[model samples]
Target chain A: MATLTELTPKLAPMEPVPFVVRSIRDELSDTFTLELDPPDGVFEFLPGQFTMLYVFGIGEVPISVSGDPAQPSTLVQTIRGVGAVTYALRQVRPGDVVGVRGPFGTEWPLAEADGHDIVFVAGGIGLAPLRPAIYSVLANRQRYGKVVLLYGARSPSDMLFTQELLEWGGRYDVDVLITVDNADRQWRGAVGVVTKLVRRAPFDPHDTVAMVCGPEVMMRFSAQELEGRGVPQHRIHLSMERNMKCGIGLCGHCQFGGRFVCWQGPVFSYDELAPLLLVKEV
Target chain B: MPETLVLDRSGLASILSELRARDYLLVGPTIQQEAIGYGPIDSLDDLPQGWTNVQSPGASHLERRDDERLFGYVVGPHSWKKYLMPNEVVIWRGERTDTGFETVPPEPAPAYALFGVRPCEVAAIAVQDAVFMPTDRVYRERREAAFIVAVNCTQAGANCFCTSMGTGPAVGEDAVFDIAFTEVDRNGTLAYLVEAGSDDGAAVLQTVVGAEPASDADLAMLESVLQEAAASVTKTMDTDGIHDLMLANLRNGYWEDVGGRCLACTNCTMVCPTCFCNTVEDTMTLDGTTAERTRKWDSCFSIDFSYIHGGPLRMTPEARYRQWLTHKLATWFDQYGTSGCVGCGRCITWCPVGIDLTAEVAALRRVDARQGLSVPLPEVMA
Candidate 1:
């Protein structure tokens, strides 16, 4: 996270410099990924940080960076064209220009969890924010212990990073377990909530750093199951998403209890957020 | 380290002229739509002469005072945030052309001399300073350029609790007020004991006609006036362990009761001095050639404030009201390292339903002993 108050942005706070879309790839029916040529040079950002993407005259929304942290040349963002702003952003052609602000918020503990077993739990489209951390772990695969990824989607077709999931499953060093809420006869993997696979996943709970992201209810259940496995609350981090504007923390839209999810979080340990997550509508 | 200057019967007029001479757009208290609103002030006559306000839960009335004091009334519905953060402003404007786009940069903040600012409002400005400091662009510019002239309160409104909040009826020596004044009644005529907090204010005072250095007795009278003002505030919000109190009772039953009465009309947030939540609006021409991203005041009470992929997180009035109250009383400290409220009574007075937060906090404390997700219970309102 941006803990230092003095490291302000280089550009004018609200002003946006435009960037051209280099490529577009459709991940799912409603979700797509946009890779943009950097406005200045390279759009450097930490794993799990987000940017406020603006569609010229349409609007802006906070989208997490889904690209590799090491690749600073191209900025990659996943959009679930759910709102007017995201829908407008998806309408952009390859050469079209758009606005970008920030690379704000805290990063995943990929560096801190280097010596520990890493378990990544993702639900539905939650993999977008966790992708950067996965890439980081793969780049420095020798530095980590056991690596496991437990992903659950609404259906097989709704899953994200399908190609990468298969590639990781083929590796002997990485454990990739996939599940779905409902499936047809064509499917062979487990068909249940992701929380059920927490017990069967191969990792020492005491020596693992768990990073989870998904729907709130799924995250809550996954966290509970993880805690039940004897993994400490502080060792488990959840990537949170909340409504926010002016990602610098001026606008109060992203306030989750006392924590501004835009700045202080986006990645908060279960120990810091257990009390808040338990309450409904908090 | 500046001494108080005494301005005679014509001193008020000279002060107004001096401010106008500096090319500052003077914004002060005035009568607008049956309320005291901060608007343009051309002369001393523009002030609400003898008007006093009576504010209570869900109700407020204007009454004529017997004395002919210039600033007899306390703060009304208007706050200084309207000028600094603004209700709406085009922060970024862009025009699309054939090859690329042209841009019209945001305009600079205007030079302003804010007259008749109260002590509570001053504290509120400080709270906002910590919030917008990180992105210090428009807010910092407007706040830095605008001169502040704080006036010590002669009386407190019924809903006011500045004393309890420790953001006073008196502007202290440590305050950032450019010039502070205490209105006094000398025999039958009205006079002012002026103290300059900044060098610019002292320089302006030196050029004023008929201005003389105030004596020790005059300074003592100013103390007495502030002491009386401090004793007059009736309301209170017991901030003792407020942070944990609200956090522990997130699902407190009393919140449901407050939700039942809250209209969610958002009058309270609009009138609040330190409520700095806002939303950005994008407007473009029919041809889509030009676009402007304007920031407007927003309330957490609004459903869209929490809208995400599935739907709005805070769906019910109870949830929205809980978020707003908990944010104002508790979570604000964690976010900005300071209390969000300044204890100004605008939220209480301007609320159409009169859902007082002071009463709500007290009620929350009473019901917290048996905390649960229980149905709405009888209110413990005082």
Candidate 2:
């Protein structure tokens, strides 16, 4: 039998763009933000989606973009020093360089929130991603009504964006509330899990577009709190984070049941994530 | 239109030499190390002249045959994917520059000729065709331009389950291959039964061999060999309702047992010609001026393969093992419209733990058959 030589199609590029770290801001003890300048038009990323930062000798890791997508000059990533790549990235300061691939994955659907009340609920470093949604909504302040932000952290020191939280709390059009797991001597406002803070907030469940990002346990409980307040399952969105190797759907690591989180979604409504949540170890 | 011609056994070497003279790469089967494998070939002498394979339950091996026949081996460890997808293909290389970064796509292999290709491999090639040649990628460009020389199996191996997979024994001359050949032992001397499946194949055959209409006896012998091949296969898979069975058995405790023993070494995928998962790596120079993004073959079994924002979605080996097996055997049908297994049995031969897909299917079948029975005391105790 004769062999057939069929020409393959054009391949898609999954390469990482190189970026140099301009500075590493020690935002908190466990959290830091890396400011990077990738060529001229480098920082083209939405808030909820993440970039796979490559550190030579230590491998690459996915970190969410903490900066606004509107700014296309400098790429900024807020990272937790839990792994090797993040740890190496934390060591880099002004002048050290790293590689960046992506801004990969589908971003949160901000267009879907038009003419709807924006409710942002963030816990600990979960605020890193929520900051963009907050900034975007505040930038176009007149498009929606009753902007309620409910934030909770492990402790007062672990709270990110404290100044921004206070400033937003004093805004006439914004309602911001902050809580912690347990208040230390320096803490004053409230001490409880993030879910407890939701009970004290003003919410018209039908009119709200609630977005939550945090640890799985915190997000799960926060969504439950929203549900208890009669929020529609489709209206409450959560940003999901899984260990990702290739931001492309090819790698099986980020699969949540039948769905590839990288390709299908990183931000899904509770109704969408509920079935997958039933799969244990998912 | 492509022409058809027949060649004698003596003409094989001349044709090979002619192609070699033209500088066209010729690859065919040979006895490589332990088993029959595909590699670059110079003459008919390198072909597996009298070898056959046996596969069953959980093993596969090659054996010598009494007849001095060429291209006699059953499915081997190597498939056409070895050439289609090299062990490593540099998709793109980026270099640090004064401007920032530049990327260069990896060059694919040039056009070549493949000989002694089997029908099951043709089916496997079709599967790869769906994978790499469609939607996106230059995989199709390389495939469409290459030459195919296919051979029909005169004898089927004991482990030959292509019939069960609905792939072969013999393939139609009207599709897939360019040239198809059937070997015949004509009163102790070997003669080839040939047909052109494409115009290019006819053109090549016209330059290489003598023309003769295949005899009735030769046709009958070819049919009988095909019938014998169909009967020789000892392994069979009941694909009728396997997908539902696998989906139902997801939480059946058997997975946990398999997972506990699984080393997660990913040998099953690496050896499987159809598995196409890949991982990308980016690197910078010592000066940090340039960088390149490289894609490498990745296995689903690795812990890093499933990293999410916080950690791995499938943390336990049980979950990962379940994902691989279920996706290959069950969900692949939904995704690719065909069973992933080609009945080649490469995974069984390459597995460190000897985890056989056929055996796994049989076990699941047995378990399904006994669903209404009372639970065994020993099973309950365990």
Candidate 3:
């Protein structure tokens, strides 16, 4: 076995990277995004992959890369201040130093998505992990046939990357749809559950890869919706997240059924997690 | 290559004293709070002398024998895993400074030797080797530096079935014990048929025992005692088709029935020699300038163990029970190439409500027989 000293992370030294937080957009009363500079290196990541951003004295949190993979490392993380680690991350300033650990976990079914239409559905801060796919399709322009982005949130204010959503709708190559559970006055968009938009998506079931990431209920509902649409269970992908510390399989905290989410996958097909899905709470 | 040596009772004492004088933190079995626990000892007197543990259906206690010997028990609650995998380990600490945050790595402890480890316990260590000390960087450092003295078991506990598990009764060829000893009664005088499995073990034996030779009869008696002990085992588990039986029962109602009574205290996993699930946490000092990263033993019984973004994946005790059992019995073959349970019986003995795994497996087998159907689960996709 290789020594621990030899396997320590050396690709990127444990030094702080400088990033100017351009803005703190409040997607919801509790959920927000700290849009910062592209790191020194090209921060490339596939959809469903995440990065471990270290806040000084506050420890690291695994937040998904919420920007386009084609662009040079402009990191955007949507987070909820649920625990101490995240609460500390939420307090960072416009100019702060944060260390990074990943691009970890199996990214969205990229090879499996070839020659297939893509449908992306996200809920609340769950959009953070799937936004990369939305960007990938927009950047590629002609690689995919049809692309659909369906996102749902608690309210209109909870919608993330709204400006990008509007721009995506204007694109000739992609279709963008947003839904919210409740809306106050001045809100103009779909006002229902995201599953309702599944019927309106433009794509063939056999040639589509439906990606869903959100609250477990929303993801489950979206999976059922896609299954109803005749998307083979193996072709539909879902990005899963858990409370993790090591972001490596060593921690053993994020195992789904018998598979380690950090090692075997963070992105898995419905056919794979289906057995566990039926067993309740999974 | 193996080196042979003989250490009489007096010579064995000299070696123990030598190890103690060197401050190697000699850990062995001793009666602690009425239960035989493995802990640091200063001299040979602290060993489990004539008293050996008698483990039964639901209880374990020490029993006195007429003769005096260092290792007379099959196994106690203390396995080598406790020290190697540790209940709590500090990975590193980060402190906030004006310049930035600086992280300090945890210090590794001095080298130590575990003496009088039973053959089954040695087998348990080898199982842990597949985990922590695997072809990974995680536990390589700790395992490579540790030392073990394997002691042959001459008697099987009432709950012991390691012979059926293909693990023990005596140390096998591939076991990584530095030195192994098989106790033998030579001409009514007690002596150990010692063999050094490593150069370090041979050097220590040469310095202490100072014996040039031992007869083949002494070694044969050692083998005979181990064979008798293996033959005397009263408990057994047919692990051959056990994995298939468990995999078939994924949706079996027995899981829910038993899980309803489970408290989710994870006592079974905590006492299990092979359950190595853990969780990591980060904490900051009151001043908020310093933080420490620590990994602590965790169990599958907790709701947070399989938590996704919004909530736990396995919330019900029934679902959690199914996960734990299937992982230990069925999927473990896929992960580690063997059943996770070593038949140490610690889980059966230490469970608060006395959830016996042997009984559970037997019940499942009965269910399989009554149904007259085999379980058919799809091949697990990688």
lDDT by candidate, in order shown:
0.86, 0.72, 0.73
User: What does candidate 3's lDDT look like per residue over B1-382, in tens digits?
Assistant: 3656777887877767766665667887888887788888877788878887877655788889788877777676667767777787766566665645666654665456888877777777776666555333335556666677888878888777787777788887877777788777778877887887666667677778456566677666776888897898878887768777876566666666667678788887887778888876667788877777666889889888876555676778877877788788877777778777777788767666767777777777876733764343222211
lDDT of 1 by residue, A124-211 (tens): 8899999999999999999999999999999999999899999999999999999999998899989999989898999999999999
Local accuracy of candidate 2 as per-residue lDDT tens digits, B1-382: 3332346876666567766765668888988877778899988988988877666434667788898888767767777766666555555566655644455555755666778888777777766666566433445555766677778776666555677788777775434877788777777788777777777766666667466766666677767867876777676666768777777666556666667678888877876767767776656568765455555778888887766556666777777887887777777776667777777667776677777777777776676624742222223212
DockQ (C-alpha) of model 3?
Answer: 0.34
- Runs of candidate 3 with Cα error greater than 4 angstroms are A1-23, A35-44, A53-60, A183-188, B17-23, B134-138, B212-214, B307-310, B369-382
**Best candidate, TM-score:** 1
For all candidates, state DockQ relative to the true structure: 0.47, 0.32, 0.34
Please say which candidate is ahead in lDDT: 2 or 3: 3
What are the chain A TM-scores for all the models, listed individually?
Answer: 0.95, 0.93, 0.87
TM-score of each: 0.95, 0.84, 0.90
- Sorted by DockQ (best first), the order is 1, 3, 2
